[model samples]
Target: MSEARAARPWLALLAGAGYGLFYLYAIGDVTLYGPPHWGAYLTEVSLERIFTARSTLMFEAIAVIELGWVVWLFSPLNLFLALILAGLLAANMHGVLYIRAHPKQCQVGGNKAFIGALPALFAGGACCAPSLILLLGIPGLGAFGALFGWLLPISIVVLGINRIWQHGHGAPSMLEYARQRFGLNNPSTA
Candidate 1:
């Protein structure tokens, strides 16, 4: 393969490995903190009811799905995974936004990953709001929770659109230092 072609696979592998590390870290944090037990969110409900083993199992299953997507980032299937991953990222963002909105409720320490993962958690929440509503029995909370659940996706979509507008138009131009650091320029050209 040409050098550029060869580099693609290695770059993909690095991206996958990075995502996997991020996933593991996020799951570990959630397990350690037991899912943000403050406010009127579904997380609070889950904690209040002491989510059944089945519910916990389902949650773990979702985490595994996310991990799979992260791993797939190394493969040619990354394009497909990127869309879903973006939604997950958005959900994380939503979580962060929630925490920011309710500063008194956040229990996160100074962990950099925790700070970074907040936005992702929010984005993930937005992406999965419908499922969350169904699983949590949204109707039981009457109109308020139902309205919140219904609005979640719209918010996420808007956030995504804004992000795309802000960052999607540019093509990368490598600086000499960046080319050296990432080994990204064409060897023959150099």
Candidate 2:
């Protein structure tokens, strides 16, 4: 894989973690319980009237109103969260395609970094903190979501760098590097 493609997953994961931090702080408490409250800044005469206007198009109304609502709230946290989520979804899609393309390779390491993202994302959520603490039986763990947030990305980054280095030193690629690193280099019996 090209360096850019190799780096894409790591970059997306880190970006998601950063946006998760934003979600944990400024906007998380207020942004998600329901639709944003209508603002006088958006409506022509009144907030309710703007939403009730006859000019609102069926197909475009949701998009326009949502955008207006976010802008009316005047916080970029939602946009940051949205973009980060899009990046993560794209990365996971790429990983899925990679797995489909490389059937001969062992499945264990192929998309593990991608898989690690699920828990990493869970730790990002405010509500998941308690579950993580409960499951691990650590009292203060819930308060460290931000720290746990970077763990997956950082581990992926280290592994990616190691793979790139291995490839540079004449190992074939990350798959080959993983096989060797994990002593899975034996020929496949299948």
Candidate 3:
């Protein structure tokens, strides 16, 4: 296998983790505060609060965890949602890497994988902040504000569909690609 193919899983995992951190940061669950060397431990640990939202709004944080340089408001629902988004993003990125590594084996374009990631990036900032809707200052937009809550879900659906579409189109195993590239034709077929 090519080095890139061998490292595909690791690359996707790294990408997913990075995206998750960004997602948390965007949603205000995680924040950068204090000196770099500072750190703290988890606080307000409660099982009852796990399922309960502090407010009536969706995606409310349940617990506060402080690691001095970074503070995280732990919310299971939001974390799960972030994981789903991150997984989908990782899958799409994996596809892009595969396409780049094995161009001849794929019928679909590589850019679709990248295009599929756009929705998640766009929606990440709006997860907990509906400031965009308020900034519009348009009358009768109160109802529209609810859409911001669905941004992550909508992104999930889009990425899911894009993944299905891409996979349904064409993908070849790395072993097969390597065999073809190296002209290691099967003797049985020959």
lDDT winner among the candidates?
A: 3
Tens-place lDDT per residue, model 3, 79-108, is 887787787767766656776555556654
C-alpha lDDT of candidate 2 relative to the true structure = 0.41
If both were scored by TM-score, which would come out higher, candidate 1 or candidate 2? 2
Clashing pairs in 3: 39-68, 40-67, 40-68
Error of 2 at 37 (Å): 3.6
Report lDDT (Cα) of residue 172, candidate 2: 47
Candidate 3 scores a C-alpha RMSD against the true structure in Å of 6.7
lDDT for residue 125 in candidate 3, whole number 0-100: 42
Stretches of model 3 off by over 4 angstroms after superposition: 1-7, 35-48, 54-58, 111-144, 172-190
Best by TM-score: 3
Q: What's the lDDT of the predicted structure labeled candidate 1?
A: 0.37
Query: Global lDDT of each model?
Result: 0.37, 0.41, 0.63
Give the distance in Å from residue 146's predicted Cα in candidate 1 to where it truly belongs. Answer: 7.2
Error of 2 at 104 (Å): 3.7
Candidate no. 3 TM-score: 0.67
Model 3 residue 183 CA deviation in Å = 20
Per-residue alpha-carbon lDDT of model 1 for 1-190, expressed as tens digits? Answer: 4434422433434544454344333323222333333332122233423332222221222111223113211221222333444443443333333333333334432243245554534554453444455667867544443454334345345545533322222212223223754677767796
